[model samples]
Target: MSFSLRPQPARWFELLTAREDLTLAVETLARTGAVELETHSETATPLVLPDLRGRLEEYNRLAQHYQHYWPQDELRPSNLPGRPVDTFNHALQRLYAWRDAADAVVRRSEALRGELYELEMLREMLLAQGDTPLDLGLLAGAGPALAARLFVLPPRTHIAQIPAAILHTSVHGKVHDFLLAVGPPAEVDLLEQELTLHKGRPMHLPPWLQRGTDASLAALDQRTAAIQAEQRVLEQQLTALQEEHRLVEALGDIARLEWFLTHVEALPVSETFAWVTGWTSDLDGKVLQQALDRAQVRSLLRFPDPPRDKVPPMVFHNPWWAQPFELFARLLGTPARDEADPSRLLVFIVPLMFGYMFGDLGQGFVLLLAGLLLGRRVPTLRLLVPGGLASMLFGLLFGSVFSREDIIPPLWLHPLDQPLLVLAIPLLGGVLLLLLGLLLNGIEAYWRGALRDWLAMDAALLLIYLGGLGLLLTPYAALAALTGLFWYLGARLQRAGGDLRVLGGALGRLLEYTMQLIVNTLSFTRVGAFCLAHAGLSVAVVGLAEAGGHPLLSAIILLLGNGVIIILEGLVVSIQVTRLVLFEFFIRFLRGEGRRFQPLPAPPHKTERT
Candidate 1:
């Protein structure tokens, strides 16, 4: 298991292959789940690539059109990367075949659906007439001599305009007036023009529906049932068609090949060959090399010293228990290849600080349970398990449970009882932690062969800080001045060009660093302050519970109070822990200059498929 203190390692490789074998080389490397190809921007790309890209563009458009039908799962490439033209053409052929078979059914289905909508609307208008006789033979367009029609007039239309000679009956609806009119053809036609002027719509039943209201409704229902049955039959036909053509799997193949071609198109190539370079995990590099030989690809692979020009990708190899702590370190970024990885350290540091601020046994168990229930879905909350365990440990020390102190005796003094000691302890711990940070920086500098430079600047800063802390606990008042003198000489000799003119500037820099050291050490006091706040909140909750009038009332208040403190204080304490760990601790040594490793994904394993 690679721990945080040890650097993650990678092996750099370069590959030279005949242009034709380039596809197989990529395939081998990719399928082995290794190799990040580096592009040489200076190398001239060959003509073959542009043609390949142009062809892939067509498949890309086709993919977009059918993208909704693609499987939700991962897609595996069905074609070798070398045959870019063939792969795209194959995808196009399958898509066109499916579209040919499916289009007719789709169009018919659409037309049938449109007809069904109109039939349903007509049925609804008939039903709304409600026990009133609907005689299509008597309505206008059906009557031979005297024309009769149902004119749905707008609510604001002038009814006085209806000719007194015409026979009419009216029914008022919420928004329109339905009027049945019988008159000479000429007069009814004139009335039609007037209703059209008022922006009113017309409703008419088919002539065949001249049967009484009950019989017309039955006929409408029978026709509706037939149309619905036909729609169901079309749906089944479409499903069978989709299955026979394997439309979804065709889409998956098309998508997979599209992804493959895009990745390989950026190679650094000459007229006849391509060069691929990248860093790989050592084991994967060996596997890729072996696979190339087995596949008889005309290629040469070499494991070379890491490139000086670019930062090699970093891969963290940590034990399972320490894995979750990676989230904290990643908040900043991957650690620089030469600097420290903070993940393992956080395993101890984060939970300790978190537990110190939120020391309660029952709440800790609640968090632990929550982590168990939800950790898989929400990865960040996985920290809750370790944090809760640490909180339980601290709860034992502070003698608190469910915001009550009477359940257990203190293994250590309660924060409220000796707030001074609570405040003082973290300060001392802070001194040690800050000292450790400096040491880690010194160690990193030494690893990089720059220890002398670190000693010149950071070493002086460290001594001055220690001397300042010494004044509080020991007889070392002059120690600060002596360290300040050392800083002056070191700065002048190392960075100031040995000029006396910059003396004030150097001294000012020292004073600035001195204040920073003091402030950074004091920042840990917030840890103790939050601890006291938690204890006080617990006291208030218990007090409220005691003041309640009835036993049930007290229980309710106590339960509710515990829940609020658990959620609200839990969030506050987590934020504090992240703040302290990130800004306070990590800034001491991490520069995050390394690149994260990204291996080419293998062809995804086939999901449910033909």
Candidate 2:
């Protein structure tokens, strides 16, 4: 029912083009987004693009500079902007002009920022002087011979203990305050040591103070106001460039194209022709060829078997309904090239498990509506629609509506009424799922030429599972035991080509496999456990609602309790369902270790001419 085994197939390709046509060829490949250039292949050599690197750095710098000014969530078409991508020389010319304009504004803004910082510092220091009567200019001149110093002291410091010969004044503040003191150079030095012991710190006057505190503060404030006005004008000019975003985008695209050209490794097959080899779909290779032909770029395309060391990139081929579940598989990892695609399997099983546990018609209806609303916006939430529908079906069978079991006759047994069945059903399902996983693993192993894995563990496990299920009578059980025993001993025989020392490893693996089978099957019991918990929780809420003395109070309690059960339990169940699918099901066989295929980024979509 799923595309678990059907993945997109790709063929390796080597594209040869003239040296002069290399850029066009590469651009064409990038635009098609079909070819994955073998950057690691011997033919792929990094190209030298000094000019491109410089331009990329410049464009990146400019983008960061104006990023804050760009409008958020603006509507833009997927294709390239209306204008054509500019040539390198032309783009550089525009970049230079834009950079020059932006640089001028940046320079003025920085200068204003520096001036404003100095002004603020001056104002703070002057304010710290408190309402001192001494003229700041006089204070500056006083420090010339006998050094006048500003000392900040904690409130608890004993200022009176200082030598009386030193002239001093104190102003109390929040945690600490200023102490303006003056004395002979040597005496002031001795007094400073005493202040350090009391946790006092010294403040120095700014070099520009040439007048009284009040006059200096007033002058700094005026300068700060002027600088602020200038900064505002500069910011406005920079923000105005947001309208020219398309130009900026074009610059970025051209820079990236050039960067790619520099980094891509291509083999020079001849004096004039350079070729890059990579894997792409047959259809995509034809598309790339056509694009190159139209550009008048000479190219040779060929398909060949990939080298043994090379692992083909995996591309999932699934129906539209199963596509969303692929997101879940991708989260764990992509399937290995030779492994099965589990997206369809996940789609079928995950929702089924969730519905079985979270059966409730009213709540499921609400969930279905929520899923529909959110699915349009969030691709991952789309899975919830099918899951909700499953829950509604189970709810109908259980004859439960908003936790009131008595509201309708039971089409199936209630969860609390037959707790053992609840537990047994999930365990049985879990065993079947495990067997399915083994079957799939065996199939994958055979395809991958892993005969040992196919026959030893998966095949043996299949027989044991079937035997446990009471299939094939007494001979089946005896054959399953014999197969498992042979598998346990087969590891020793296969180790290092039948080395005796491998006996230890063989025993360890056998134990590990046996334990895994037991634990995996038991893990499904949580499904039934959670199902019963949901039913018990519903009953408890209903009991509370019925106990309320007033009918209105009972109605209110019932409504609130059902809402809590639906929202809170629904979230918890969803997480648990995902966990079972991933750990209990997917982990059994899904390798998910394959690297994702990365195609070259395409140019912006080009708008059609009317």
Candidate 1 has an lDDT of 0.75
Worst 10 residues of 1 by lDDT: 601-610
Off by over 4 Å in 1: 1-6, 14-35, 41-82, 112-228, 261-264, 268-276, 281-302, 306-308, 480-484, 487-499, 548-556, 598-610
- Per-residue alpha-carbon lDDT of candidate 2 for residues 1-610, written as tens digits (9 for 90 to 100): 3335746655677777776556556667777777777744554555644365565676567667754443334322212221212344455555556566677787777767766764654465567665545565566566457778777677757854878778887766555666778888777887888888888866655444555667777766676777788888887887665345344444444644554455465444454677777777543466877776765666787777787778788777677988888876787888876677877777778888888888888778888888899998987778789888988888888888888888887789799999999899999899889878877777678668896766865676566556555543465577666666676577447646878787777668766876878888898999999999988998998899999989999999989998998789888998998788777777777878777767766644321111
The candidate that achieves the highest lDDT relative to the unseen native structure = 1
Whole-model lDDT values for every prediction:
0.75, 0.71
Best by TM-score: 1
lDDT of 1 by residue, 231-285 (tens): 8987787768756766555555555555556676566767567788777875356
